[model samples]
Structures are given as C-alpha cells and as structure tokens.
Target: MATVESVKTKDKKREKYIVTTMKRLFKNKLAIVGLVIVILQIILALFAPFMTAHDPAAQNLANRELPVFSDGHWLGTDNYGRDVWSRIVFGARISLVVGITAVSLGLIGGTILGLLAGYYRKLDAIIMRFVDLLFSFPGILLAMLIIAILGTSLVNVAIAISIWSIPTCARIVRGSVLSIKEKEYIMAMRSMGASDLRIMIRHILPNASAPIIVFATMRMATAILSTAALSYLGLGAQPPTPEWGAMISQGQDFMWSAPHLTIVPGIAIMLTVFAFNVLGDGLRDALDPNMDLQE
Candidate 1:
C-alpha cells in the first residue's frame, strides 16, 4: 500500500510540473484587458476599408470642424471635415507597419552584431565601442538626427527608428550571450569540436532567446511612439495618409472646436502603448519562472 501511495504521489508531482509548464499566458486580468484592446486595434486596421463608411482622406471644407456626436459624422470631423474615427482606424495600419518593420530591422541587425561580439572576444572591443557611441545619444535624439539626415518620409522614419533601436537590442543580446556562452552545455558543445557557427546558432542562441524576446516586444511599443513623434514633426507619413501623428497635428488648430481629433488619436496612442507594455510585462513574467515566484 505504501509503494502504491508513493507511486501516486510521484504521478501528482509530474502532473503539477506539466501544468505549470503549460500554464495559460496573459491570463492576468490586466494582461487580458490589454490583449483585447490590442486585438480591437488590429481588427480596425485590417478592416478599415470595409468597416468605415467615409473615405479617410476625403475633405470637405464646408463641413469642417464639426463637433463630436453631430451630423452623419460620428466622432466629428477634423479640420478638413475628414472623419476623425475613420482616420484613426486607417492610421492603425501605418503605426503597426512602422512598429513591426522597424523592430524587425533592429532585431536582425542587432542580433547579428551581438552574436558575433559575444562569440569572439577579439571583436568585442570594436563592437562595444560602436554600441557605446550609439548609447551616448538618447534614443529619440538619435532617431531625430537620423531623420534630419535622411529627410522626412515613411521609409526614412522607419530607418531612423531602427537605427536608434539597434543599439539597445544589441546590448541586451550581448548580455544574454555572455551568460549563455559560459554555460556547461556550451562548453560541452565546444569540447565536441563543433564549428563556431554551429555552436552559436545551435547552442548559444536558443539559451539567450528569452531576454531578446522581451526586448523585441518592448521595442515595438517604442517604435510606435517614435514613428508618431516623427509624424507629428512632419517627418513621417505625410498628410492625407491618416497617420495618428499627422492627424493630431492637423487637429491641433481646432483644439477648442473639434477636440475629438486630438483626443481620439491621443487615446489610440496611449491605449496601444499601454497594451504593448502590459503584454510585454506579462510575457516576461510568463517566460521566466523565477519572476513568477518572486512576485
């Protein structure tokens, strides 16, 4: 009976381990709420053509500066009598595109540099010096400088944001690689005469991926904000494009008469950034078991 009881206890322990390992993520109330908001934003972006009744770019000076909850234009019209809600909906595409593309560029560039630097001590000094140079400038300032040189356009804005983000991603990846390269498994692989490429890709990268994943998630939010800032400054997606930043810029003149233009996009930016941040936090906690226990 004691033997049977012991066997059952071991089974329970195994079940517990499996359950914890496969626990549902983003289940926290805040995280779930954030996810819902993000999903709505994505849906709005994807279905803007079908969902919105008005052309986002169509302008009517006669009906300009209408107040919210008035006429056929719900959420009011902007300075040009363009639908504020429709513009906000369409703007999601530009924001998401910039965020995802810029972050991807940064991730690819930074990961390569970080892997190289961490794997080869001889290259570390050179890579670290360049990273230090980038770090000297604040990220937004660095992006602005790049934009100044590249000139204002959607592609230029993306490039500028990616450049600023690369150093941060590289630094995080380097730190992770530093720790991972010293692990017993890495040393074992090295001892087996694995090629450098094989060792870095097969052994080192997998172990170092957690921090990189978190950084990428956070960077997406930063990219969105940066893109918006560029647009506000007339350096990003141009007028008639329905970008959030440009929308806010156009709405500033009618701040008193039609506040929806500013308020709506402002809310959009805030909610999007907040969602990404909360999701990132949740992901960080979920991925790191130690973090869960610490809380």
Candidate 2:
C-alpha cells in the first residue's frame, strides 16, 4: 500500500511538472506560433490523403506549370503537372519521418555512449576520442560523405543524418552525465550499492533529460533541413517522389516562368525548420530554472 501510494504521489508530481512546463511554453508568442505550425504540419502529414484530392505522384502534361491558385489545383501545378499542394502535404510525412527517426536513433546511441563514458572512468578517453573524431568534420560534409558511400535514397539520408547527429548528442549527454554523476543523491545511490546501470538509467538519465529534449527538438530542425538539402542535391528522395527538395530541384529549371515550383516547396521547408527552431528555443528557456516565465 505504501509503495502504491508513493508511486501515485510521484505520478502526480510528474503531471504537475508537465503542466507547469506547458504553461511556461505557451506564454511565449513565438513558441505558440511554432507549436501551431508544428501541429499543423503533423496533421497534414498524418491525414495527407484527406487533406488533398490529387495524387502526388500522378502526372498530367495538360496541367503542367499552372500558376498558383489554379482552378482545381489549389497552390498550383508543378512542371510535371502534379498538384504542388498535394505533393507539399505529402512531403511533410517524408520530412518529419526522416527527421524524427534520425534524431531518435542518434539520441539512443548517443545516450548509451554518454552514459558509458561518463559513468565508467576507464571508457571516457576512448569514447570521447571517437566523438572528437566525428566532431572534426563539419556536419553537412560528414552527412554528404556518408551519403556518397551509402548511395542516394531517403533511408540512406536518414542514416547519414543520424550518424552526423550522434557525436553532438553524445557530447551533450556526456556533459550532463558528468555534472549529474557527482551529485549527493548519486553518491548516496553508490553508497547504497545500487547497480551502476540502475543508477544511470533510473536516476541520472532522467535528470539529464531536459538538455536532451531541447537538443532533440533543435536537431529536428537541422535534420529536416539536411534532408531537404540532400534531396535537392540529388542524393535523397528521387524524382516523382514529391519530396520538397527533389521538387525544388525539378522546378529550378522553370525559375523565371514558373517560380512557384521552387518557391512553394522552399517556403514549406523554411516554415517547418523555423517552427522547430522557435519551439526548441522556447523549450530550452522553459526548462531553464533561471529563466523567467510570464505570469
């Protein structure tokens, strides 16, 4: 009964913390806008078929390069006569899936490495040296190199981005662990003979999660942007896929005559990245104990 009551108390505290964090997040105007954009994007991605009538992959030569607000095609028709709006709507899924997947994999791998490096003194130098080697290259360059070796495709792009993300995430988690491991409670746990894995997983990781959450949010923006850039460069989502970057690449030839081809998808990428960034900033501030929240 006591254990069950303690668990209920902990659950209530967690719920209260979440509520307070959300309230703080909502207080920022930019964060609210970002949240709205992100929510809309997720909705579009999930309900894409319901959101648009046209097939993103289906082509019609007759409707090719139609201007924005065209009769049936809401946003316009691309050079291939695919409805730009439909394609953009569908593209949201590709972008978000790749971004979220890459970040998740990277975070998992990084968190493990960080825990090992920070907790076990003998492994610190070896793990950190590996992380430093990855950090030596610029992120984009590293991703491109990975793609070049792995071959061009959306999955490959995600893999590349995940690899690029790992070092940074590892560094962040390592820092947090380093700071957390020396705390009084952590020492108490050690003195109580709690297993290292239990101490790291159950205690240290939760305490280190704020920074990781902020990093993951911001990294989503980077991952999306990177996916688009890779696709634009012909190393991701091939033609007829309706990927924003591939769309941009396909449309660049009609820049003067049918600028909407490039402009529309470009705006999509921009807004999505912007949304994630501002939301991440809001989260970072909200999570910071020293930061002031609006009343």
Each model's TM-score? 0.90, 0.95
C-alpha local distance difference test of each model: 0.84, 0.93
- Candidate 1 per-residue lDDT, tens place, 1-295, comes to 9979978997897677546633645456676776787788888878889878899999989988888777788888888888887888889988988898899999988998899888899999999899999999998888888888989898988888888888888888888888889999789878989999999887788777878887887787898888988899888888789998888888888787777888899989999999888877766766775855766
Q: Could you say which candidate leads in lDDT?
A: 2
Ten-residue stretch with the least lDDT total in model 1: 17-26
Candidate 2 local lDDT, 99-216, one digit each (tens): 9999999999899999899888899999999999999999989999999998999999999999999998988999999999999989999999999999999999999999999999
**TM-score winner among the candidates?**
2
Over 4 Å off, model 2? 1-13, 292-295
Candidate 2, residue 49: the lDDT equals: 98
